[model samples]
Every structure is written in C-alpha cells, then in structure tokens.
Target: MALMITDECINCDVCEPECPNHAISMGEEYYQIEPSKCTECVGHFDEPQCAMLCPVACIPVNPAHVETRETLMQKYVRLTQTAA
Candidate 1:
C-alpha cells in the first residue's frame, strides 16, 4: 500500500529529503504524500522513509490505495525509468 500524511503533520519539511521517490510535498498547513509516487520504500529502502522520518508519525498506510509488493516494485521502476 502507498503511504499518506495525516492532519497531524507539521509541515516541517524534514520528511521530504528522506524520501527516495520524492513523493512528499508541502500542503497548505501540513505535508502531503503523492499516492502515485509512494512505493512504501520497496525499491530504495528496507522500510518507508517518510514514516521513518516523520516526527509526529503522521505517515500512515494508504488504505484507499492498496497495492501489492509486485505492483509497488513495478511502479517504482516506472517512476525511476528515464528516457533513452
């Protein structure tokens, strides 16, 4: 599953750089996670980076966008792929 930022987020900008997929972004008052780009750290780390770095632990699994490991890995590859 992808990850999401909760209303508890402080928009400290600490989690942004920790994400390898660049999925974290600032919102009007809190940080947000792009579900399309969130891989749950499948390709780049042993665990979810945003959740790891979140001071308030606002990062949570996106129940609305459930995805299997295979799907997440495929998306990771697609996201990192570059033009030839």
Candidate 2:
C-alpha cells in the first residue's frame, strides 16, 4: 500500500530526502506522498524509508489506495524501468 502523511506531520524535512522514490513533496500543509511513485520502498528496501525515518510517526498506509505486495513490486519495476 502507498503511504500517506497525516496532518500530524511537523514539517521536519526528514521524510522527503529519505524517500528513495522521490515520492515525498511539500504539500499545502505538510509533506505529501505520491501514490504513483510509492511502492512502500519494495524495490529499494525491506521497509518504507519515509515511515522509518519520520520523526513524528505520522506516515501510514493509504486506505484509499490499498494495494498488495505484488502490485507494489510491479509499481517499483515500472518506475525503475521508466527512469532508466
């Protein structure tokens, strides 16, 4: 599943750089995760980097964009391929 940053985010500026996929960006209020670029860090790491590094622990699975591991892996593959 793609992860999302809740309003609880403190704008700590930590999560954005930790994301390998470059999916995290400054939103109107807080950092936002782009679901299209989010793979739960499947292709890059064993766990989500943003969630792991977030100081406030505000990142959470996006219930609106629930996806299986297979789907996330596919997304990772596609992203890598596109970047290449």
Candidate 3:
C-alpha cells in the first residue's frame, strides 16, 4: 500500500529526502505523500524509507489507497520505467 504523512508530522524534513520515489513533499501544512508516486519503496528497498527514517513516526499506510505487495511492485516497475 501507498504511505501517507499524517498531521502528526513534525516537518523535520527528514522523510522527504529519504523517499526514493520522491513521493514526499512539503504540503500547505506539512509533508504529504503522493499516492500515485508512492510505491512504499517496493522497488528500491525492503521497507519504506520515509517511514523508517521519520523521527516522529508520522508516516503510515494510506487506507484509501490500500494495495497488495504485488500491486505495489507493479507500480514501482511502472514508475521506474517512466523515469527511465
């Protein structure tokens, strides 16, 4: 599943750089995760880098964008292909 940044985000600015997909960005109030670009690091890492590096643990799976691991891997492949 894609991940999301909650209101609990402290805006520490750590997660943004950690995201391999560049899905995290500064929102009007805090950091936000773009579901379209979020593959939860399925293609780049074993775990979500943003959530792993976030100090406040504000990143979590997006319930609205729930997806299986295989689906996430597919998204990751698509994203990488597009970038290439």
Q: Which structure among the candidates has the greatest TM-score?
A: 2
lDDT for each residue of candidate 3 in 1-84, tens digit (9 for 90 to 100): 889999999999999888899998999999999999999999899989998998889898999999999999999999999999
Cα-based lDDT for every prediction? 0.88, 0.94, 0.93
Any runs in candidate 3 off by more than 4 Å, and if so which?
Answer: none
Where does candidate 1 clash, by residue pair?
Answer: none
lDDT of 1 at 61: 94
Model 1: per-residue Cα lDDT over 11-62, one tens digit each: 8888998988888888788888899999999989989977887888988899
Can you write out model 2's per-residue Cα lDDT over 1-84, one digit (the tens) per residue?
999999999999999998889999999999999999999999899999899888889999999999999999999999999999
Cα TM-score of candidate 2: 0.97
Which model, 2 or 3, shows the larger TM-score? 2
Model 1 clash number:
0
